[model samples]
Structure formats: structure tokens, C-alpha cells
Target: MKRRSLIAAAIAAPAALAAPRVARAQAQHNWKLVTSVPRGLPGPGVSALRWAERITQMSGGEIRVQVFGAGELVAPFGTQEAVESGTAEAYHGSGSWFSGRDIAHSFFTAAPFGLTFDEMHAWMYYGGGQELLNEFTNDRNLQIFIGGGSGVQTAGWFKNEVKSLDDLKGVNFRAAGLYGEVLRKVGVNPVSIPPGEIFAALQSGTLDGAEWVGPANDLAFGFENVAGYMYAPSPVEIYGGIEFGINLDAWQALTDAQRTMVEAVSEAEANRSSADTFHANLQAYEKLNAAPDLVIDTFPDDVWQALKDASREVIDEVKDTSDFHRRFVEAYYAYARKSTEYKRYYDTPFLVERESFFS
Candidate 1:
């Protein structure tokens, strides 16, 4: 009986190995995607994994991707460089990670006075934002796609009331990219620390406030437990949208079929992440408000105006240095201004009245 079983197993092995060429090709073409987010088993970490799964399946398992998060394969801050150098083939993370490349990359994550999730998508998909973004990367041999967009964000969690413009003086805040520069202009001491460190910074008195993503993320990081004041209308970012970018060399090597699959999945998942975050924020608002000692607040008129002006100054500083930046921003604001005009006339009545909403 043992000899008969061994003979049958030997016979079955050949059947399983019928496709030798396909197996060899698949083994040779596996790729990797680096992410700054650390949690990898599921949820957000699974994003890169999902992209991997779809690409592999679509390419008949010839295109496998290994998703490594945060420090699994490289240091958190070094992902962009790693991908650019082909030390890793790709990266699935925030656009703000590459702010050093150009400040406009940070706009995809958060910009002072940016748009809502749906609005940005409309702008990106139909209003020509994606094409303009391509133009930004055209010279650098880089390609980016919106991996996710966290909708309208909360202003921030704070230890004290920010009732007037003067309150920001010397405030030690954790922020990033040009927003940091803009905040600096207002006399706030803006600092960049990894996202993993924000909760501890807030708890240990190392930070006066923080403008990390929004409600879904704020609650995820347990901000509701520490910061007593919750500010709204997160003008610096009505959205916290994350972008996934890859080195152009890797992208060019992909077969046309493989490229299409990656683009479609990344674009679709971006919409999913944005809408999911939008829903999560609404639910988190209730949870945040329910906690003890938590006060919901808003910046006064003068404070808002000062923030706007400071943000404008930062923009003026960067505009001419890169024509792509100048042209892209002009196109976006043209649509934005048009949207504002329409919203003012049509939606303000059912929405917040402009006098109350703006002033």
C-alpha cells in the first residue's frame, strides 16, 4: 500500500508541474511596494497587499508585489528616495513624504485652505488635476496616483483655546510640509515628527497642539483621550488625501496590461478610501464629543483671516520657482473659484448661510 501511494503521488507531481514556463516567469517577476504606514496585517496596510493581489491575478500571477510598511524594509522617511533610486520598486504612502521634491506634493495630502474629498476628486478626475500632477512629475521620472483621500478634516486637537490670532505665538505644534512654513509665519513653532510619535508628543506636554489628519485618524491615534479642545473647519486641510507614487523606471517595464490593472485599482481604491474616511469622520465626531473634558471650538474671525493670509504668503513664495507649480495652482483655483461662486448662490441656503459660514 505504501509503494502504491508513493507511485500515485509521483504521477500527480508531473500533472501539477505541467506549466513550467509560466512558473519560471512568475518567479522572476515579483516586485515590492514600500509604505510608511506600519500596520500590515489588515486595514490600511492591506492596501498595498490588495494592489498586489489584483495585479498578480490580472497578470496571471506573473506580477507579484511584496508590500513592506514603515521600517519593515526601509526607514520611514526614506521611502521616496528608496523608490526613486529603485532600491525599492514602488511605495504606497502619503504625498507629503515627498514635499522636499516640491511643495505641491504636499497639496495632495493637505494644503492650507484646501478642498473637500469629493471636490478634490472632481477636480482631479474631471477638472484636470491629475494631468497637471503628471506634469509635475514629468521631469523627474516619477508617477503618482491617489491611493486614498481622507475627506474634510478636523481643525486640530489642542490643549488650550485658540480664540485669537495672538494665541499661536510660540505654540509648539506638530505639522509638516508647507503648512509648517505657513504656521511658522503666524508665530507658531511648527515641527515635523513621524505620525507614530504624535500621540505621545501630545500626552507628554511635548506639543501644544497638532493638526494630524482628521477624525477617523485622530480617533485611531486616540487623540480624544488627551487633548481637551477640538477645533473644527480644519481650513489648512478640508481633506487629508494620501497619494501612492512609483519610480517611472518600474512603471515603464510593466506590460500595458499590467499598467492598466494598477492604474484602475489605485484610482478606484483612492475613491473608496476617501468616501470611507468621510463616513468615518462623521461617526468619530459623535465619539469625540462624548468624551469627558473635550471641548469643541473654532478659531475667531481674525485668527482665520491671519491663517489665510499666511497661507497665501507661502504660496506667493513658491509660485514662480516652478512653472508647473504656478500653472497647476492657477488651473485648480480657477475651478475652485467657479465652485465657490456656484456654492454661494445655490447651496448656501440649504447649507450654512455665508454670513455665518464665512464671517
Candidate 2:
């Protein structure tokens, strides 16, 4: 009782869930966590297992986290809802998957050309993005972490080669967040499905094309198996970041020692996820390219321009209602614009630095 009340003093809305739950904790000794990702997706689940294992070992069997691979327990998209409602102790997922919760979530997952993984970490941890996201979570009896990212992603796989907007029109695709909105403008029938189903969706012919994470994840989803025309420079996505959630009651019920372990392990999971994607995605790309029939393509200049224009329209609509989102876009682009301008002096113009040996 003392521990419960004391812990509740520091938390804002969590006290509601913590107080009643902790009084009963003396009756139960360990925790069980449910996650949504499949066994191997190069995202949150893989990162979490490594850290969760360490916590299990250190706790000497007192603390336990049981990871439920996708569809093993709740449906993949149901993770956050499960956590909030106490069906699970935690959730491993991406903001992109739950953008339906709040448009503000889209900012965390990565806006089009928003921040890269490291840049987002910088902004989330030091630049107030974390505080903002938690503000949203805390309202719902949930607690969370930055949960790292899968970095950038390929545009998608396509049946017919896309030379221009003409190719994009009437195309049925798998996409998420504001990207879906942008796709609609370009005449794509964009659908949102959980990551676990992308490959099956593609395989069954329900989807004309799809893109999931970077190369590594795409490969894991068997993207290479169906690659017809692989496209790049996804005008709709720059970075795809995953988000982790902990039930507020479950988090607060832990002892101080347990609290430290949870925080440390979650942070470690974030780091591992980022690093794993960096190296693994490189290998996945090789597999994609190794196939003789695979046709790799980059969007022509006009196509890129058209997509960019459509994306801007989507951004403006998102900004109109979300001051938080608007501010984020403003701050992010502020940095990007400055970065682009500075790079123009030395990076954009390429004669291979004629004065160098190569010249």
C-alpha cells in the first residue's frame, strides 16, 4: 500500500490505475506482456526479445515477459487496444499502425521526409517529441517509449512499371497514415493492413502492391518472391518508426528495482531495433537485387514532382486541425531547409571534386 501510494504521487493520470492495482499486487508476483509483431519482422518484436531476455535472467525468474507473436494472441492491430484495456501488459508496435487513434501519432512514426531514425531519436529524446507523445498516451492509461524505427522504406512493389502519374492511377496498394490520403489523390486505392498480412495480401492477388519497412523486413515478408517492379523514393514515407506501450497499472505496480529494469530494457530494445535494421536491411536489399527477374526502378523527375505536390496537400490538411502536428512539421522542415541550403554549396554540385585524385 505504501509503495503503491508513493509511486502514484509522481504519475499524473496513472494514479487512477496504479492505486487499485498495486493493492492487489501483493497477491501476484510476476508480469505477463503481450506483443503484436510476428516472430521475425526486423522491428519491435525482435528488438524486445533480446532485452526482455536479459530482464528475465536478471530477475531470477521473478519477472517474466511472454511475447505473443502476431495472430498468436490478439490480432496484430489490436495490440494497443489490448494494452490499454489490460488484456496485455505491453505492446510492441508502430505509430503508423495506429494512426487511426490520433492524427498526432503520424508525427511519431515519421512524416514524409520528416526525421530519420537518429534525427527522430534526437528530437524525441531531447527536442520534446517524447513529452508530447506521452501527453497523448498518459490520457489513455498508457505509457510508452520512442521504440526506435525500421529506418526508411522502399516505395513498394508494383505489377506494371510506373513511368508517371498515369501508372499510379487506379492502382490498388497497401499503405498507411497520411500516405493513404496522398495515394487517394494520385488515384491509388490505398488500403491499410497489419504487417503480418502484407505478403499474404500480395500473394493472394488482393493487393496489387505493398511496401513494408525497409529491405530486410520486405524480404522477411517474402517481398522478393513477388517482386515485379520494385520502386524507390517513396514520396510518402521517409522514416517508419515503431512505438512501444506499457499498461499504466502494470508499469506502476513494479518495485523501484523492477521499474529501473523495465526502463533500461525498453531503452535497450530501442537501440537494438535501430542497429538491427541498419545492418539487416543492407543484406535484405542484396537478396532483392539478386533475383534475375526483379526490375528495380526509380521514379522519373516529373513523377517525383507530382507525388511531392500531392503530399504537400496532405500535409496542409493534417496541419489545419493539429497544432501539435503543425508545430512538428514547422520545426522539422525548418531543420531540413537549413540542412538542404547548406549542403547545396558543397554537396549538390558534383564534378567529383575535380581537384581530387579521381578527377
Candidate 3:
């Protein structure tokens, strides 16, 4: 009986010790995520809220994220600093918001006339984009995840029609990222305004034109009521990509399983948000087109050609900003060229053929 009791005691002790560790591993984490978008706004804002909900659900409530919109926890452009200072665990915003820190940051958001939606996704996930981003953020003591995107955006809302390149000259345009640089090259004065302030700028004649997300977000912001002309094929951001920037220390504090869960949910949100924005934009476009006061148009051929030329110049100038910037730009363009070629052969022709039948 004494021998049996000794063996049972040893087994029970080990089990008891292991049980606490398991419970600790499954402990709950309540994290705060600050966004560069206003709460409930379409596209990035809505996506952030959904991402937080998903993280909670996927982690079985072991990890709960409380999302704060622009200016709630920090100003719209202050998200990066907030994360870096450990004031917030994470941030959801476009990488372009940090371009002032390094122009190369714009590559992660969008490049003027750069990669399309599918191509951007391919480059970021399969190509070296993610690795480059990780390196960049790591230097700042933060980690980045490609969170969400507004597939392809509209040109902008214009108070008047833009019939030629001359119309763009001296126009007070509200632009961001590389698009602002490209617009400047073509003689437009790019106004730096936060997303929330854009509507008021336009209404008060502070801005001649502005490009927000797509029809859904634009309509929600009442751009249609302020501007008469809505243009298509935004040359600024072919694809608007948003990122999840988390503090390195906070991220490392998570268990391996928790880290994996965060990454998996972020990628899932990227796809889900893009699709949601696309569908919403489609519905909004249908409604906007029916409005008699609004005029939907595409840029004239000459204007588009000039913008294209200016975009090339802007790209060349930007690549020389720094060694890292040069490398990123070169890699991006190389991948973009390859993807463009593929689309030319496959996607472009298929779309043209399909449209011919419809017309």
C-alpha cells in the first residue's frame, strides 16, 4: 500500500503542475487597436471593427480587441507613434500615413498607377513585399500585417469637369501618398487634409477636388452633394492597402498560438474587407448614377496621358530618396511589370471581349 501511494503521488504532482501552465497559456488578453479611420466609416474603418470582432471570435474570447477610431485614442496620423510608444497595442491604417517618416512607406500603401488589386496581393504575400515590410517595421520596433484594402478607387469628386490637363493645373487637390507627389508634378497643389476633414474642405471651397475611397465611402461622406462630377479610374491609388501595425513587445508577449491566430485573422480580413467594399461600391455606384445632379465621367485621353507621364517622373524621383526606397521601388516595379504582362495577355483581353458582347 505504501509503494502504490508513492507512485500515485508522483503522477498527481506532475499533472497538477502541468494544469496551471496550460491555464496560463490560455489566459485572456485584452488589447486596444487604434485606427486611422473614423468609426463606422466605410472601407478601412468598417474593416478594422470587423477584424477586432473576428480576432475575439477566432481566439474563443481568449484575446479581445477594443478598436478605437481616428481621434478616439489618437489622431488619425498619430497611430504609428501611438503603437511605437506602447500607448496602443496595434493600429489599422494605410502605410502612406507614415510616408513622412520614409517615402518608401508609400509602397506598402499604393503607388501611382502601380499594381492592381490582385497583383498587389500576390506581391505582398508571395513576393518579397512582406519580408521588406517586416524589416522596415522591425527597425521601428513594430510588426506589420497587411490588414485590408479598398480594391480600386475612383478618380475623385470634382466641383467642375476636368476636360484637359490644363484643368488640373493649380487645382487645390486633396491627395495622399504617392498620388500627392504625382499630382504636384502635374501642377496641382495637393492639400494635406485628414479623411474626416475632406468633406468640409470641399464644401467650403478649400479644396477644388478630392479623392476618397470608392462610391460607397464617398457617398456616405456626402461627396456627391458637394461635388457635381465623379470621375473614374483614380490614377492616384490603383489599390489602397491598409496595414495592421502592432508594437513588437506587445506582439511578442503573445504565445505562439496567439500570434498565429492574429496573423491568420488579419489575412482573412484583408480578403473579406476588399470584397465587402467592392460590393458596397457597386451598390452605391448604382444609386449615384441615378441621381440627376451627379455627372459620372472618365478623364479625357490627353489628361490621362499627361498624368501617366507625370507618374513615371514621380516614380523616378521617389526611387532616389534612399537606398532602401530604391530597392523597394525597383522590386515593386519589376513585379508590377511581370504582372502587367500577364494581365495584358489574360485579364485585359478577356475583359475587352466580354465588354464587346455586352455593348
Candidate 4:
């Protein structure tokens, strides 16, 4: 009897070893993704749609996403709330839009005199910035993933060129987040308006000037028709990037592979969107530069100086807000300091040399 049992166990072990392995079945997820911009609008708008597409495609039907443009499902600024309340599974937009809830959110999106695209991307992905974000968003029941960016936005579209620092005083301008605060410090009355209404506002003289994304988007909206001057080097928005805020409960439900797919797709889209914006901006800029009526220029030196001073004051005030703000500010500047050191030696010199060589 013992011999027979041993022989049977040996046969079963051989059979098990020879059997083919089966892959684990992944659960299907259907999500609604809301955006803060109109559907198909260039830059962040189109990038949001593409982000949804890539996730759906890469998942091989395991994860499906449906996207809703701003106001289609919820108001543009309601994106974070929608995801937090589980009204939507995810949201795509700038985190700075919701900075009123926590000033720390601005660093993840746009901060006055903030890091550049490469610097911001590195800070988030490798410099422990995302961990800080996780700490902030966990309380709101949200998770963040950096998705896309607008690289170096235009200064603004002005009805007339700002000739002096005094010109900005009492001017009603459309700006957002920390940008608005900095402008207010410089004596400009900043107004927060939705993107859809900006053109109408500019046309009707409600806004003396407005800062939108950059050349690609500004030209698309036909700001040149109402605003004669388009300025460069938006001080507050060196690199404004978009983020994906997912419902924490929904995120937790995702399989490990599915979660990884979401992150991988987001990183890929972030780099792609930045590159796409730069290319589109260059092409659109060339066209706008040739326009007979539009004038493209930079802010006068005095105005730039005033803006820089105001930016410093605003950022300093934010540091005194709370311990969280202090920590976030410190972390941001630490990385900025390290990054600047490298840029000075390599990027700045190379850029200057290239310009000199070309000219």
C-alpha cells in the first residue's frame, strides 16, 4: 500500500510540473475622465483626449475611458471636486486650479517663478515631489499623476503694449492661481474667468489683457483680433503642467498591472505633450509674427522688474502660511537650487553660444 501511494504522488508531481501556466484574468474598468478645457482644443485639451485614448488602447480592453470636456459633465474648475466626490473616476487639468484648497498644490502645477518643464518633471518623478503630493491628496480621497504640460507660456495678449510699470496699475487682467496673486501685488486687478469666456471678455473690453497658454492656443482662440499685442515669457508660468486626479477608491480597485499602465501612459503623454506644444507654438508663432496687425513684444524692462519683485513678495508670503507650506516651499527651492546650478553651466551657455553662432 505504501509503495502504491508513493508511485501515485510521483505521477501527480510530474503531471503538475508539465502543465501549462495560465495568466491571471484582469478585471475590466470603465472610467469617466473629465477635463478643464473644451474638447479638441489644442494643447492640454487635445492632450487630455489622447491620454484617455492611450490608457484604453494599452490596456487591451481591460480598461476603458470616456472623456468629457469642461462643462459637458461638470464646470471646468469642478474637476477635482468631481473626482473627489466620485462623480468621475478621473480628472485632467492643472492642479493649481484648486490651489485655494491647499497652497502646496501650486508647486505641482504652476508656481510663480517656478521650475522649468524638465526641472518640474524631475522634481515630481525623482525628487520625492509626488510623495508630498500623495500626502496632500490622500486627505481629499484623490491620487495625482502628472500627464501633460504647456511649455513656457506667453506673457499675455494685451490691447496695447505695457509701456511702463504704472501701466499695469488697476488694469483688470485675467490670470489664475499664484499668477493672479503676484499680479495683484504689482497693482494689477486680476480676474479669474473660465477659458471659454476669455475671448468674449477681451472683445468686450472686460479684460485689458489675458494670459492664456502660449502661441499655439492664443492664436487658435483668435486673440489677435481683439488684442493687438502679444507678449512673451509669461513670468508665472515657466512650465505649467497638467495632472490626472483619480478617485482614490477607484484607484485602489485597479489591479497592479492596470495601475502601472495608467502611470506609464501618463509619463509618456507628459513628455509627448510638452514636445508637441513647443513644435506647435513655433509654427503658430511664425504665422502670428507675419500678421499685419498683431504686434509681438516682451514686457518693458521696468515692468519685468516690478513683476519679479512682486513674485518674490508673493512667494515669501506663502512660506509663512503654515508648516506644510514651509516644507513644500523648502523642498521645491532645494531642487530648484540644484537644477539652476546645472543649467547655468550647460543649458544657458549652450543656448547663448547657439544664438551667437546662428546670428
lDDT of each: 0.74, 0.72, 0.81, 0.83
Report the C-alpha lDDT of model 4 over 1-359, residue by residue, as the tens digit.
Answer: 34333322332232322112223144678899999888877777888888889888877766789999989999988999999999999999887888888888777767776889998889887797877777677667887888767777888888877889888899999998888898898899999897889999999999999998888888888999999988888888877788888887787676556676787788998899889888998999998999999988888999889988998898888899988878888898888889989999999999999999999
How many residue pairs clash in all the candidates, one count each? 0, 0, 0, 0
lDDT per residue for candidate 3 within 164-195, as digits (tens), equals 88998999989877888888888989888877
* Candidate 2: tens digits of C-alpha lDDT, residues 1-359: 44334334543233223234344345334555556666554456667676567777775555777777877778867988998898888777778777788787777775765666666776766666666666667667787877677676788888678887788887779987777787788788998786678888878888888866677767777776765888885665665777678888787767655666676777776787778877888887888889888888887777777777887887788778677777766766676565557657765465356557475
State TM-scores per candidate. Answer: 0.84, 0.80, 0.88, 0.89
List pairs with backbone clashes in candidate 2: none
Write down the RMSD of all candidates, one decimal each: 11.1, 5.8, 8.9, 9.3
- What is the descending TM-score order? 4, 3, 1, 2
Error of 3 at 157 (Å): 2.0
Q: Where is model 4 poorest over a 10-residue stretch in terms of lDDT?
A: 15-24
Off by over 4 Å in 4: 1-23
TM-score of 4: 0.89
Model 1: pairs clashing at backbone N, Cα or C within 3 Å: none
